[model samples]
Target chain A: MPAALQATLEFLRAYAGPLIASLVIVAVLPLIAGYVVLVERKVMADMQARLGPMRVGPHGLLQPIADAVKLLLKEDIIPEKADFWIFWLAPLVSVTAAMLSMAALAFGPAFQIARDINVGILFVVGISSLGIFGIVLGGWASNSHYSLIGALRSAAQLVSYETAAGMALVSGLLLGGSLQIRTIVEEQARQGVWFIFLAPVAFFIYMVASIAETNRAPFDLPEAESELVAGYMTEYSGFRWSLYFLAEYANMIVVASVATTLFLGGWMRPFASVRWMGWVDFLPPLLALGVAGYCVYRAPRQPVPVQKLVMLGVAGLCALVALLLAVPLLLPAAFFLKAGIHGAFWFVAKVGAYIFVFMWLRFTLPRYRFDQLMRLGWYFLIPVSIVNVMALGVGLVLHWQYRVNLWLALGGTTLLTLLIALWLVWADRKREAEALQARGGPGTPAADSYAG
Target chain B: MLDKVIFYVFGGIAVVSAALVVTRRNAVHSAVFLITALLATAGIFLQLRAEFLFVVQIILYVGGIMVLFVFVIMLVNLDVALQQIQFSRQKWVALLVTLALAGQVGAMLWWAGQPGKKTLPLPVSVAAPAEKLPANAEAVAHSLFGPYLLPFEIASLLLLVAMIGAVVMAKKKV
Candidate 1:
């Protein structure tokens, strides 16, 4: 090869691993997000006392694939007045921004695709926020009143919640003493406690703001079907719409991954530092085994041979995964394999738990009015997070200056925040009661429910 | 070679989009172009190995400020604005401001490309070798929380004042 060509090839060789890893992540994430959608539907169905999508495959296992095909085959439309180029570009922007945010995420110690950027957390935050551009632009280009209003609401809501979420992240960053996701996880491992135990309020704020950021229910004013008629997505259809859907779920996974990495200890088994709890390392395979067992249990109960065959195949797949997980445990000498297996397993489990919580919240909470959502973000979450950040800062100062124990310092701050939270709740309730009395009726519009 | 290519590509995008921002007939299109320009600038910042500035530029400018600009554009009576003369009322004032800005930008660029000054290569510094430079978030935090703390506080107070002023101006009862 020519000298410059040789250098270029060498550069490609060096970066090919990360390049391939990122490509895999981009490919796999949408599929994962698809399954997440199915899981969300199933969980929501279970909550609402209904069977959801059972006919697609054995217990709706193939539902996501079916949905994918339908979306892919549907006609892509652009309204006559719509800005055609921007209309086409919007969903691409949304999905690209969301996927790009994942570049900074350390999936686990072993599974991370990108080199750990120093400004990892901020990179994720910045790129993820760029997705709002797609929403605003899509709505604008659609040339519809509902789309415009939805995008405007989304823009406002995203900006407002971001402040709280950023503050919440700062608190965890303070505890970790680093911006790198891996460093944050390692900090939790060293301390023998998840940051969630120390910064519960920060975690709470993050969870709420993340939901709002993702435009999930209770804060989903942008897409309030009853109000905004699918909101910014009003004009979208077919593959274009699926791209937005993929972006939403991918963003969900990103936020959940962040929460896991920052607050819950990225890939550490609970009680990781303790000697007796070493067995927790085996939990991944055990869980896989349990899943396989459940598949086996359900297999014979299927009405048809095809369903039974599918169930059996699922059970076999789960068993294979369990075997793979266990193989690492047996290879005591292979540190890389062990770490990769356990790290990915624990990391994914934590993400799954967070996603489940997201689904639970979505089904349980009623949608908030736009004003109420704004009030919660600004008055409640923002102020609370600010206080949390300040108190944590003070605690860190005390610990550094006076040689106070880290746990003691964090505990004191947590307790102080709890007291402040109590006062805030009380004050908010009092204001609501007064407003309710002024309105003068139980069934009146905008009446405060808790007051009565 | 790759470094030169990237610099030119993004720089080209920044210039073209900035021009579009000013020249677009529709206000919304102008805002969108402005965003494109801002993002291109942010990409340039990243290439410069100013990761802190890159993220801050994206988050604060492209994400926050541009959204506000878009919001205002959407809210305004764009139809009426479009119907009005493109170079109405403040043509001379606008020209004067643009000239001034162009002059300033020219001076900055001229200074930047001076022979004695080293132009940092854009592409090969994914891992920037400016170890001596205070370049990361820690450096930023230290500066904000330490020596420059007073100025930071003052800046925040200024923002608070602006916010309160806006609220007061908006409230008819007030």
Candidate 2:
């Protein structure tokens, strides 16, 4: 072979693992995002007393695939006045940033693409933040008022919440004492407790800030449908629109994974450090088997033969997974396999639970006005998170420097933070009342309500 | 070989994007190019193994500052500005200044490449072995909070003052 070809082969050989992993992620993520959307629709339907998309396939299992096909086959459109180059590139930027952030995330002990990056979690945050450019650029390129306003709202919302989010993450990082995703999880294992219980306030702040950061409902003033027609996405259609949708879902997963690794103990089973909780290791396989059994039980109730066959197929698939999970536990020689597989199961489960909570909130809560969203981020969340960080720091100092009981220190600090948060809320309410009085009366409504 | 290739690619991107940032007629396009340049610079930091700096550059510069830049650019009426003269009247002066800076940089590069010449003045103790060097974030934290704590605090105070000035300026009734 020629020298250049030989060199290329050598590089490929060295990077084959990450290369394959990257390929898998790029291929699978869009499908995963689609399923997530389907789940969200189903959840919303359940909450709202309706069935979601049952016409597509068995229980709408294939709706995402159908949607994907439709999106791919749709006509691509661009406005006459649009900036052609940026319009073409914007969605690609969004999706690329969203997916690139995943490179640093540790999905399991054995599954990480860019392993051993010193600034792992920060890398994810920083790269994901870069996706804002996509929104801003797309909005600008569309040459539409709605798109520009939506993009601007998004930019402001993201910038405001990111500060609180970063501060909350700092509180967690102080406890973990590391930036590497793997190290953070390992620290939780070493501590015999998750960071959530120790720094509950930080976790709460992170949860709220993350929702706002991802532009989910209640905090989703950026693309508020009744206001801006799909926000920054007003001009996009077909595959390009799908790319933006995929990026949003991918961002959800990324934030969920970050929360899991930092506060929910990444891939560890519940009570992971407790020696008496060894039985939890068996729970994964048993849970899969339980799912399989439930599927089998429901298979006969399907109204159509095709639905029944699909249900049976799902059961079989679950059964195979259960077997796969069980075999490694039974065999001592496959220790790494057990750890890797079980770790992945728990990690994905926690991430799913997080996403479910996100969907639940989306269905339950009313969307906040843009001003209210900004107030909550800047006035409420920011101050509380800052105070929480300081209190947590003090608690850490007490625990390490003054020989205070760990639980006592953390619990005391948490209570103190809560009290401070209460005081802040009361003060804000008072200020709002005063401002209302200054505006003449409460009946008149706030002047800035529709400012955005 | 891989590291050199990666560095050159990123360096080339940074330079090209930076040039485009100044040359773009549209303000939004200029902001986008600036973001590209910032991202490319962050890549260079990653290549140099200054991991904390890499993320900080992305988070603070590309993410925070560039977003604000784009926001301001969008809020402004760009059509009127775009229709204005693209170049300033200081062409000769600008070229002269650019040439002088280029000459200074070229001279420095030549001096560094000279045989048996010490490129940088440094204490022997500052050059630690790679194995003994602290993690990037730890080293930064140590310096920021340890010996440089006073300076860091002062800088934060400076930022606070600037922030107050901005708020005061933006407030209608203040």
Candidate 3:
């Protein structure tokens, strides 16, 4: 080998895990995340008097991989007038933006790709914000009129939502007292309380922000072909087009993963009775790594079987997570039982539930207008999230004076939340009734929408 | 040996791609070349063992910001760069200014260079330590919040301000 080649090999050898891990993650994360998409679709299908994607597998398990192959082999076209190079670079930018955040996500107690970054949560925000560029460029480079308008809409829309999202994430970071992902997870493990209980308002804001960030369902106005002719992708075809789809779905996965790590106690189970089992504290970390590895290696070749294995593994991991959380309350036996019931089972169950909701909204909701989307993000989510952050801060300061128990604090927040929800619902119904009275009669539909 | 391999491979590519970024006739082509240059610089960061910076450089710079640059180049809708945008009689003036900028950078770097040590100032490891990671992380956390906390907080606030400014600039106020 030449001298430079020899040196390059050594460098690769030295930093093997991260370099290897990044490459591996780039390849498999899309596959894993896309399966969640299929699961979402199927779950939604069953929810509304129908079955979905059952023919692909015994229960449509292999649908994602099947979809992947279809995308890969699909026809790709390029417009003559398009700025071809920029159009090509757009999807790579989107996909790469989503994947790069993994460096800061330390998965296990010791199995982190890199460690000790002081500004991790901030780094994630900074880097993820860059996704705006991809959307803008993708829209513009297509050289179609629709694309430019769509890209413009996306640029404004994303910027507004991202601020709200960043503030929502800040609420989570404040509860942890440190920015590191692993430490945050361990805090939840030690306290046996997830941030969701403490920061329910933040959690709701984040879920909404994440949906918009991923450009999923009703928030996907930028790509709604009914108006903008495929939005930014009107001029793209072939592998290039598929790249954009992959990147979009991959970003959704990334957002979900962030949600998991931040508010879902990461790989820290809600129950960890296994730690008392002598070397059981190690299982949550192991399960995390094992699933990531197994999905990467086995998912491509035998996707149906691999997905089944992964799903089962997630259920088990959920139980473990629950057990880990309950160790404070339950001792070793309680830990194991909860791991079986709460920790390992809960993650898979929640992820499954979230995916179902994702698909449900996908099928049922009408796409928002670009202006409406922006208004929702800025006017609604941002203010609410800011209020939540201030409330959490107030609660934290008052903790010492009040001698407030964690459960009591949680109960108080929960009750406050219930009251707010009820009021919002009543207010919405009143507004609807008033609008109906103004329009003509209660039975008459609005002129603009048939569904009404 | 590894250092030399990285230097020759990525550094060479970086230099070539950067040259192409300016020299290419097509604006879109120039953007692609810039992406290549950015990727190679990320490789250099990887070789230097700043994994966090390396990832951010690619994710934020190569993937995020550069894509916007390409978008603007494409959306501005030029069949090609007009004579005004390309080489002109003022080309010599532009070239001279670029050279002056380079010289200034070179002089500053030369002043900062420590010949005593081989590499620039940064923590070194092929990867993070398998053990002692939490200690390393804690030290980093302490350093960030301890001495560098002011600058770190300022950077985040600056970003938030910039974000707000961008929204203001882009939005059509009704």
Candidate 4:
């Protein structure tokens, strides 16, 4: 190799942990995040009693690969009026913005890729906003009407939802007391609880905002197939289109990782053994026996083999929430159990469930009308998330019994929100009647229950 | 040596394109020249071991802002004006202003070099080699949070105001 090449290789090898980890995360993250898309398709398909991608791989596991290949092999066509350079540059920006958001994700305790950052959440939110610029610019640069409209819709949708998303995230940071993913996870584990239980309102708001942020389900009006031809992607075809898809799914996984790290006890199993606590003994001490047997006198590769490959691949995960036994916290057994609880399975399960919800929404719900989508984002989500943030803020300042108080506060907010909603509905109906009388035409249909 | 080669190529592109930025007759052509200059500047940043700035420069300036500029130029239908004879009555004044700006730059450079010791490093020394630059977003964040916190907040607020201003300016009614 040339000296320059040699130096680059040396630097890579020297920082193998993070360098290799990042590569693996970027590479394999898409593979599994595709499973997220597949799960969405399958769940919706199965919900509708139709199979999704059955012919691709065994049980359609290879569907993402097949879809990717199809997109790649397809011919790339550019409009004559298109600015070729910006057309090329747009998707690259979107994908990089999407992928870089994952840099701060903490998978499990002691397993983070880079642990020193104090403002990981802030970093993610800032990066996530950058992705919208691509869609907006791509539409404008295409010099097409359809793309422009789609891009404008996306710009509006993203800006509106971002406020809600920020408020939702801020609530969690207030409750969790640290912006660092592992630190939050650790505090959750030690407190013997998850943030979802305490911050249920925030959790609900987060889910709604995140779905909107990822442009999933009913919020996917920007790319409504029947309407804007593929939204901002209307003009893009082949590999350029594939880059947009990559960014979309990568973004889906970023949200999943964020939700997992924040709301779930990030890799902490629900039922950790009490004897492991040395306080109670309902379950027998099978953990030690299993570890030993799995390690020696049996197929050493069987159990950990599965976890190790994933662990090695995603080396820098957020450390799992640790259960600190009074003694020998540093001992290997304690560490192993802690890691096992907060490891890939927990992350996969949590992230997977949220992703399932994503697919479920896609299959079940019809896309929103464009104006309805905008109004819903601006009026409903923005208010609810702000109220949620304010409730958490009040709870924190007042030193309320947070776990119980948050639920009560959520209940109260729901009731108050319902009452306000009813008042708005009545007022809207009165205005519509007056308008109809004024125009000598029948008033528009009454607003739906969910309508702003 | 590779860094020097890349820098020279990018710098040359920057200079030529910058000239084009000023002198291109068509507005759309001038916009395209500006985009090229921005990209070449990003390439120079990459050559100077500032990969994060390089990435942001390309992503933001070239990709985001310049694309918007190109779109605006296209939307205005500058291509149709190509056949029209266009002339500025103040051409002599514009030339004089250009010469005056050049003279001002020359004077500043001469004044800065009056100590007889070079401040800026020579081209070869400025860039030792080309490789991926270390990017520590956290360190940047830390610096912003600790020392530059006020400016950072001010910048964010200014950006928010700019966005609002754009919306207001574009709106048919307030």
Candidate 5:
């Protein structure tokens, strides 16, 4: 081989793991995003008492694949007056930002793509925030009124909620004492508690702010179907639209992972540091086995023979996973595998739970109007998060400076924060009442209008 | 070799996109190019191992400030603006000022490059190996809060004043 070729090979060999991981992520993420969409629809259906996409495959298991095929094969459209370059570029920007953010996220103790950069969590947060450009540019390039409005709303909403989200993350970081994601998780483990238990208010703020950041309901005014006609995505069709969809789901996962890492303890099982709760390590394989068992139980109940076989295949897949999970625990020589495997299981489980809550909220609540959404973010969430951060800081000081019990300090501060939150709500309500009076009472048509 | 490749690639992108930002006819296009330039600059920062600065550049400059820029540009009637003159008649004066600034920077670089000559006090080399460096974010935080605390606070205060000024200007009856 030429020297250049040899040098290239050496470089590739040096970074082969990340290269393969990146390749796998770039390949699998779209499919994962597709399945996330399926899960969302299924969750929506369950909430609404209806079956979702049952005809696609057994229990809509293959619906994402079907949807992917349809989207890929569909006609690509670009409006005549649209900015062609930007129109082409927007979805790629969105997906790139979303996926790039995932590079820094450690899914398990052994699996981190960017290898825990100094500013890992910050990198994730910042890059993911860059996805707003995709929405903004797409909306603008479309040259449509609805798209423009949607993009404008999205930009404003993201900018507003991001402050609160950053502050919330700061509250968590104060406890973690580091910007690196692995360090944050290790801090949680060292402390023998998740930051959620210490900083519940910050977690709550982060949850609400993240939902807004991701543009999920009830904060999803930017894409309100009843009004915006698919919002910034109005002009997009076919693969372009699917790219945007993939970006959205990817962003959801990114935010969920951030929350998992910062608050829920990344890759660490509950009571991870507690020796008495060592039994929790066994929960992963048992949970997988349980899932497998459920699949087997439901296999024979399928209407068709093919469906039954498919169900059985799924059961077998789950069983294989259970076996893989159990092997490290069963054998002493394979003990090194236990942390990586179990950690991944717990990390993914927490992220799944977080995403489930996101979907649950989407199904359970009505969408907020634009102005109301802004008010909630700027007025409620921002102030509460700031207060939460300050209170948490004081709590930490008390725990450190005065040698107060950590839980007691945190609990007292949380109570104080809650009181302040209550006061803020009351004050906001009073202001609203006064504003209503100024607007000639709530009975006026203007007062009742959805002008926002 | 990889580091040099990455640095050159990002530097080239930054320069090209910065040129594009000024040359683009459409306001939104200009804004988009500006964002690309900022992101490329951020990549260069990351290459230099200034991870905190890299993220701050993306978060603060590209994400926050550029969003506002795009938002404002979208709100304005671009057709009206595009129809107007793209540049003012200050080409000669602008060229003179640009040349002066370039000369000053070139002179500084020449001074810094001079071997065994101490024309200026140089800071620690940022290009030191990663293992030799302290954690980037921690070093930044310590400097900002420890010795440079007053300056940082003043800067924040200046920002707060600017924010209040903006609100005041925007308000109808303030």
Candidate 6:
């Protein structure tokens, strides 16, 4: 072979594992994002006491596929005065950047795409932030007032929340003593405790900031339909609009994965170090079996023959997966397969749980006004996270240099952070009350009343 | 060989995008090119195995500063700016200044290429094995927290002062 060609082949051979993993992830992410939307709709429907999208398939199981087909076939439109090139390119940029961040995600012990990337978390953060460009450009290129304002608002919100999020991540980084996702996970495993226990405040901050970071509700002022009319996506239609939707859900998964790796011990089964908790290894297969059982239970209730067949197929698929998951347990000698299957199951479960919280919050909380969102990010989240970082630093220093007991140091620091947070909240409320008083009375409209 | 190819590719992109940044008529287009140039530079940083610098370049420069630039571009009505003269009346003076700058750079390069002359203190060449060396972020952390601690603290202090100044300036009747 020619030297360059030989080099290329050798490079590919060396990176074949990650290349295949990345390709699989990129190909499947949109479909996975589609399912996440279905789950969100179902959860929202349950919250609102309604059956969501039931007409599409058996219990709306095929709704996402139907939606995808509809989106693909719908007419694509570009406004007359729009910046044509940017309008076309924005969704592509958004989806590409979001997918690129998945490269840094260590999916499981055995399923990682990019192994041992030293700046793994940073890589994810940087690439994901680049997705903001897609939102901003999409909004601007639309040549509409709503889009422009929405994009600007998104930019501001992202920049503010990012500070808090970065600080929160730093606390986890301190506990893990590394930024590489694999090492962080291994650290938690070795230590026999997740970082969340060491830094609950940090984890709390991360939960809030990451929700804002992904533009989820309360913080989804960027796309607040009541205000900006779908915000940056107002001008987008059909496949282009679906691209933005895909990017949002993909970003959510990215953040959840990061949170799982850093705070929830990545793919480690709960109570991993405890001999008594070895039974937890069976949880994944059992969960899959339960899902299959449920699918089977629902199969007969389908009104149409086609829907009944589809439900039966779904149950069969779930059963097949359950069987495969159970195979590792049956063959104890297959350590690699066991680790891979169990690790992926736990990792995905944790991510699902995190995303479920996101959906729950979305259904429960009303949207924040833009000003209120900024206040929460800047005044509350930022300062509290900064204090969390400082407290963590002090605890680590005390433990290392002064020989303080580690848990005691950490506990003291957590207590201090809680006190600081309480004081900040009290002070903010007091200031708000004083401002309200200055505005004359309870009935009098203040300058910044956030009420609808 | 692969590293060299990546470096050249990213370097070419950096150069082209930088030129586009300066030459674009629309301020928004200029800002977009500026982002491209910054991203290209970050790619070069990654090629150099300065992963810390690469991520920092993206996060601090492209993500943060360029976002600010884009905001300013959007806030200022681009239509009015586009209608105005882009180049100043001192085009001759600007041309003269550009020529002088280019001459100075060329002279420096010529002198540096001489056999007997000492070269500029570039970063050490990529000779060390990747695994043997500490990761870039770790090395950077150790240095910043160790020998460079004073300078880092001073830089942070300066940033704090600048932040306070900005707050004061932003406030009404401050």
Best by DockQ: 5
lDDT of 3 by residue, B83-119 (tens): 4456556878899999999999787666557677545
Clashing pairs in 2: none
The model with the greater lDDT, 1 or 6, is: 6
RMSD of each: 3.7, 3.7, 8.5, 9.1, 3.1, 3.2
DockQ class, candidate 6: medium
At residue A125, candidate 1 shows an lDDT of 88
- Summarize candidate 4's per-residue lDDT along B1-174 as a digit string, tens digits: 455667788999999999988786777557767867987887787566554555567656764566556555546655677766666679899999989999997876776667775664435344332223233344465788999999999999999999999999999698
lDDT (tens digit, per residue) of candidate 6 on B1-174: 667667778888999999998788988888888888899999888877888899899999988888888877889988899899876689889999999999998888788778888674233247676777788898998999999999999999999999999999999687
Candidates sorted on DockQ, descending = 5, 2, 6, 1, 3, 4
RMSD of 4: 9.1
What would the DockQ be for model 6?
Answer: 0.66
lDDT of 3 at A449: 62
lDDT of 4 by residue, A22-136 (tens): 7977788667656666777777778988986665543465688887778879999988998776787789878887877777777766456655555566656656656776776
5 or 6, greater by lDDT: 5
Which of the predicted structures, 3 or 5, would earn the higher lDDT when compared with the native?
A: 5
Can you tell me which runs of candidate 6 are displaced by over 4 Å? A1-7, A443-452, B89-125
- CA shift of A172, model 2, Å: 0.3
Task: Write model 5 residue lDDT over A25-56, tens digit each, in one string.
Answer: 89999988988888999888988999888876
Per-residue CA lDDT of candidate 6, range A354-441, in tens? 9999999999999998888888888799999999999999999999999999899999999999999999999888888887788766
For residues A1-452, what per-residue lDDT tens digits would candidate 2 score against the true structure?
47556667878987899888898899999989999999999999999999988976678888999999999999999999999999999999999999999999988998899886888999999999989889889998999999999999999999999999999999999999999999999999998899999998999999999999889998887788999989999999999999999999999999999999999999999998888989999988999999999999998888889989988898999999999999898988877698789999999999999999999999999999888888888889999999999999999999999999999999999999999889989998998898878886655656547646
In model 2, the Cα lDDT at residue A321 comes to 96
Chain B TM-score per candidate, please: 0.78, 0.84, 0.72, 0.73, 0.89, 0.82
User: Considering summed lDDT, which 10 consecutive residues are worst modelled in model 4 chain A?
Assistant: A318-327
True contacts recovered per prediction: 0.70, 0.81, 0.23, 0.00, 0.86, 0.53
Task: Name the regions of candidate 5 deviating beyond 4 angstroms.
Answer: A1-7, A442-452, B117-127
Name the DockQ score for candidate 4: 0.10
RMSD of 1: 3.7
Is 1 or 5 the stronger prediction by DockQ? Answer: 5
Identify the candidate with maximal lDDT: 5
